[model samples]
Target: MTLNNDYFKARLEELREELLAELAVAGPHPESGHGYSTHPADHGTDAFEQTAGIAVRRNAERLLYEVERALTRIEENRYGICRDCGQLIDRARLKVIPYARYCLDCANKHSKG
Candidate 1:
């Protein structure tokens, strides 16, 4: 069955908005020293937090990139087609992850490497 275009658009848009909000609050900009701890003793804690925060930001950015790519695919009339296998993606999978670029089989194969 064909997936619902309206639902795909809305779901992706919602996710994009959420990721943007999360990025805005993503912890300290160490370069700018905006959220870093001032005390020397707290440097260790701050470093850990900074590392974790950078990871969080990177993950959110990756997700946001995928979401945007999906949106672009939709506009190009290529959404729901697996990038590797060129198969139509499962409707249920699309419902759960609107930004998915691979079908289950292709995704599984890719993940194995």
Candidate 2:
């Protein structure tokens, strides 16, 4: 069955917006040693905060990349085709994961690999 391009395009737009919002929430990491000093306690807290912020930003960046990839697929007219098996991805699965690159069988095999 041919996939509905409009529906997937709408979903991709929504996901792009959501991921951008999340990245905004993560925000840019503050400069290291801005308020930190050589004092042990102060140094520890500053280090912890910096590490946490970096981690969150990294995750946000990854999500943003995935969202962008989905948008690219939409533009390429390849959005709903499974990359691994060259088959139409199930609509229900697309509803759940608009950026999915594999259909159920291929996805299952990939997970096992």
Candidate 3:
């Protein structure tokens, strides 16, 4: 079956924008810092907040990277094709993941490896 390039492109673009916004919101702010508070509880809270912010930013960055790659593949006329095996990816999978770079079989193989 032929791939619906336009639909996937739009979806990937939307996902890219969302990830960018998430990254921006999760980034460090001037007020989000551990001030000169000597209280142990306050220090722990500050540490936990910083750690959580870092994790959120990291996850957003990773997803953004994948979304960008998908966009690039679309531009190159390579969307919906498995990178590992060069086979056409399932349309159902594309509908669900819009940014998939491999077919289910190849993805599973890579995951096992």
Global lDDT of each candidate: 0.83, 0.74, 0.80
Q: TM-score winner among the candidates?
A: 1
Number of clashes found in candidate 3: 0
Q: How accurate is candidate 1 locally (lDDT)?
A: 0.83
Error at 11, model 1, angstroms? 0.4
Best first by TM-score, ranked: 1, 3, 2
Name the weakest run of 10 consecutive residues (lDDT summed) in model 3: 35-44
lDDT of 3 by residue, 65-107 (tens): 8899999999999899999899999999998999898999999
Runs in model 3 lying further than 4 Å from the true structure: 1-3, 28-46
The list of candidate 1 runs beyond 4 A from truth reads 1-3, 27-32, 35-47
lDDT of 1 by residue, 10-112 (tens): 8999999999887776644644556544434444546567677677788999999999999999999999999998999998999988999999998999999
* Model 2 misplacement above 4 A: 1-3, 30-56
Q: What's the CA RMSD for each of the models?
A: 4.6, 6.0, 5.7
Ranking by lDDT: 1, 3, 2
lDDT of 2 at 55: 79
Model 2 quality (TM-score): 0.72
